[model samples]
Target chain A: MKKRLYIVLFGLAVLIPLGLLSGSPAWGEWDGAYYKKILGFIPKGIQNAKSLNAPLSDYTLGGTNSITGYYLSAFVGIAILFVLFFVLMKIFKARGKSEQSA
Target chain B: MHIPDGYLSPATVVATYAVVAPLWVYGFKKLKASLDEETLPLIGALSAMSFVIMMFNIPIPGGTSGHAVGAALISILFNPWIGFISVSLVLLIQAVVFGDGGISTLAANALSMAFVGSFVGYYSFMMCKKYRAAPFFAGWIALVSSSVLTSIFLGIQPIFWTLDGKPLYFPFGLKVTFVALVGSHMLFFGVVEGIFTALVYSFIKKRQKVVVA
Candidate 1:
């Protein structure tokens, strides 16, 4: 099962660049300009909504190299998720040991 | 569907977080219970797969494109709560680091894409387990269910939160939002999700003896 899972993950990771083929945005998840053009005005809340400056916003880094940035982003995301899960597993294990001793 | 920041009202944000908080807690407990040495790599890999799958935005005929959330594949393999928690983690990363989704709309997005998608997929797969196409249908049903919830969340904004005839948040009514979001998912993304799930599930099942935990 583990081997199979890795195979699938590696296969998908190799094909991750194919994700960038679509320049079109999903329906309703459009820019504020879209609302201005369609409804004649951007919704007040949407226009004024607070957005944090994400480090890797839109999966692009500082450089114009989007393909490399995308690959890097995928690697970063997977690493972070694994680190978090492992950390949680450690905490749970510590708790279980403490409970057994108690 | 990831609802960006400012697409929902403040009241909606608060309400969604309030609803999601307890479920998150419960889901985490479920995740911990399932997490062991044997399952760690599998869960992590599957979650990573879910994240990578969403990055694939396939273009359809209508000048709009969307990707399949791999919630059903996880839910059918493990369970719904596991699926929910894993995808929620994926959404958090997308929101905070990638900015693909908005922080304010995390709960709403999780509820729609993670919770609804998982349960709908799990039940659908179980109901049709006798058939070879169960995984395909599970993925299809999950995505459609997620689109419906997203439509409801977005559609209600215009109905209740308009000021001086202008919607304070999302501007479309249920009719338009449902027709566009749900209709698109059914026509384009749903099939893609179904095929992906079916293909992956079959590939993995063919090779290994999966002992469902």
Candidate 2:
């Protein structure tokens, strides 16, 4: 029952990101160093950096304008959280079992 | 930053290997001591987890996506050295199996991601776990901070202080990309990493389970 709450949290995390991605402006080009179902977010600096060949630090990398990125981030982010919660819960359960047996 | 073979001078490579070899020995010894028979599966699981987690690439604001390197996770599950070994395996797999990184730079990548990233991040995390907020902080700090540190290590030219030569440009395009790549990862991933690591660690702590490693 407790684990379910964690799952719900994970789901919510991903949904917000997906909504943002679906409503973004920069999702047009399928190529030009940013194509495919996976090549998700393109920071403004990174776009310029990749094109201009500037130093990485020279360009600022932020996700303030990224919608798909937020969605993807949330999904994977929450998945990781699920793993954590599951493992911790199992640990707790095992300890309880051990304690009662002892 | 994946340090390709030709980019680093042979001397640099040898020196790096020198620093890395002793740590390898020490980590092996540590593994031998703390690792009990009951934890055999943990080692395998850690290795598998390293291999698997790294493939799930997350797209950044830029068109490219970066995957979690898994050094911190391995360290959380086992001793840092064991995490080091496990991460090395993951790198090797990426190079050979996935064709992601170059084969020549394996040791350097391992040194940064596993040896340095895992141990430093993991130990700091261990210390941080005493407080209620530490779990989230530790996870965020471990992955995000390690991402930056590894980027610097990869980008910084070893010959910055050469006395006889004029300033070499030593263009670090990949290194630069690495920072942007890893830095972005830290900023974005930290929030999730903190939540994930804390909850996961909590689970393991709750179960009295030591990740079989």
Give lDDT: candidate 1, residue B69.
96
Error of 1 at A2 (Å): 1.3
Worst 10 residues of 2 chain B by lDDT: B161-170
TM-score of chain A of each: 0.91, 0.38
TM-score of candidate 1 to 2 decimals: 0.96
Complex DockQ per candidate: 0.86, 0.04
lDDT of each: 0.92, 0.51
lDDT tens digits, residues A1-102, model 2?
134323433444434533333221111212324322333432232232212221111111244445544444434433443354345345655665798899
RMSD after Cα superposition, model 1: 2.0
Model 1 DockQ vs. reference: 0.86
lDDT by residue (tens digit), candidate 2, B7-117: 343444566677777877777556554444345446545554454444334555755444455567567656677788667655654554333443445666678767766
TM-score (all chains, Cα) for each model: 0.96, 0.57
